[model samples]
Target: MTSESQTAGTRVLHLSSAQLARVSRALDGDEAAAAEFDSALSSDPVRLLVEVLSTKSVPAGSGVSYGHTFVTQHPTVLARVAIGYGHGLPRKAGNRAWVTWSAAGGPAVRLPIVGRVAMDEFVVDVGRTPVEPGQLMCVFGDSDEGEVPLGDWAAAIGESPVSVIACLDRRVTRSVVE
Candidate 1:
């Protein structure tokens, strides 16, 4: 069995048939499951990019998004993302998920979702970053650029990647990348 840890809390467990069964029992009490693993925690080909529709400044104690699930800690700028649970993103991601925003010609900055994820949109606290509309956000992309991983996204929202992908209906446009 092999496993590799990736950035953004992605871990892939590679196990053969026997090893896999052993792992299952090990989860019960077998200490033999402790071993280095070589798994598929590598960068994935699929990435989800969402656009920034708008941004706004809020004072401290400000409640963000629907239900006020999260409140502003201080004066910060919140940027709205263009996709949400209705678009296949997990609704549970509200205040639990993160996205990567790359400044124009700069490195990617990881931002947290500040409020409840809506039907077609979400919010990110872009603190201190002069973000603007039309900016592309890497909701889950390659780790090389500090983007979130699909696995991490699933874990954050308590779902599997398969389920997440299946939730992406025709309403969400699909683009092929080489």
Candidate 2:
């Protein structure tokens, strides 16, 4: 009935602070509210970077990853991303999900996670991309250059985004960006 009651109802629905801001935008014509919501919703706080620990050139018929879950159908370039279950990368991600990788100054390439993700690393089919030792791979996060969104990982592994992110091991090196 009253403006105060409407605002109070919106706030009572357990909406996030960002969602509340959007509601306030409609109620009070606060232009800044939209900006705040966008910043909060779209910006991921945790970005993961994995180094390429090694690379193997596999001929067709080669088994990849752990347990031979993936067998190369053709000649392929495989690289090991140096973060694994021990680093908070879920074992369930193996052979089911993908990671974003790029050569220096190159466009991002999507690579499949093959085999069982080990405790310390996982295998990716680089597929002729020129990957080298120490090249960076995005494990998960928001990047201006683009990345595998957390939702995609969730869908791949049948987990919720919160669970996917919350399981990250505390030993991970976290760097904050503005």
Candidate 3:
């Protein structure tokens, strides 16, 4: 298995425009090809996952229920990520939401939230992990041995994974890597 330092050096390698076009043309209606494409793009294409640290510390007692509980904490580190309730993240995940994240050397760490996810922000407890802004936050991507399947995440929050993925507006940018 690769170490954190090894994976951290790799830059964001995206698919070339020509290569994307070729794949698009080659797999017009082939199911297997489509599946392969999905696996390659979403899975560990580089045989490694990016390791990023938390930027801020979202405090406790911050009520996060939608149209319900009110946040009571001030110094909280809201995950400055793109995915939110509108992007399929559970709005009802009032302090129950957990995401598998990777720090330096330890196994993929599961970061628990303190409140419900807002329209564009979520809180995470970064006890002592050295994190900072612009770090790669794997909201819903690959994992070490298993993956945080979008379907499972949706099920946990009582939402349809299909609709959750579909609701990802065009504003949410996506990049394909080879």
Candidate 4:
């Protein structure tokens, strides 16, 4: 049984039939099922980090993204990120979700994902933070600034992580950095 892990990086666990049974028992609220199951599952290591492709400062009440679902309440800086539903970011993440970005000498900022998630692009309201075109953004996963946990995103979309994570498009590059 292979699962994502943080801290020590990735590991592949080949659980035997007996071990699988133990994991099943443990999941069923068994108090003393298997120590391996308890020790194995740790912080999720999967992170979808992408580059900001562009940035623009829009005036107050400006309509954003496709269909104008999000109209800015005030003048704000916006960014176009590289990922979209076509890249495995869910369309449901449109106006309901957010991403984080860290500026060189400044603290991390939470930016709302505005408008509809397109096939290959999405917009984010960066608020007052001055964002650049090449800055990296945390679409999801853990970081020093914080995290966009899978559970939070799942809750926002009324779906499970198992259903959503797999939606990440295969065409998107995936790297294993240890």
The best candidate in terms of TM-score:
1
TM-score of each: 0.74, 0.72, 0.53, 0.72
What RMSD does each model have against the real structure? 11.1, 14.2, 9.3, 9.4
- Name the 10 consecutive residues with the lowest summed lDDT in model 4: 3-12
For residues 48-166, write the lDDT of model 4, one tens digit per residue. 67777778988999998888999999889888887777656689888898777777766666778999987777899988777888778777655444757545655676765434544
- The parts of candidate 4 lying over 4 Å away from their true place are 1-42
Mark the regions of model 2 whose C-alpha exceeds 4 Å error after superposition. Answer: 1-41
Give the candidate order by descending TM-score: 1, 2, 4, 3
lDDT by residue (1-178, candidate 2, tens digit) is: 5332112110001224444445357346565654454445345323467778778898999987667988999999889777678656689998899888877677777788899998777899988888888778876555466677656666789875544544565555434334
> Each candidate: how many clashes?
4, 0, 7, 1
Candidate 1: Cα lDDT at 76: 94
Question: What overall lDDT goes with each candidate model?
Answer: 0.67, 0.66, 0.46, 0.65
**Which model scores highest in lDDT?**
1
Give the per-residue lDDT digits (tens) of candidate 1, residues 102-174: 8767888889987888777889999998788877788776677677776677778887544565466455545
Instruction: Please provide, for model 3 over 41-128, each residue's C-alpha lDDT reduced to its tens digit, 9 standing for 90 to 100.
Output: 4443212122233355546665443643446445555443334565435566546555555555556655555455666555555555
**Span of ten consecutive residues with least summed lDDT in model 2:** 5-14
Clash-forming residue pairs, model 1: 2-37, 2-38, 3-37, 3-38
* Model 4 residue pairs with clashes: 1-15
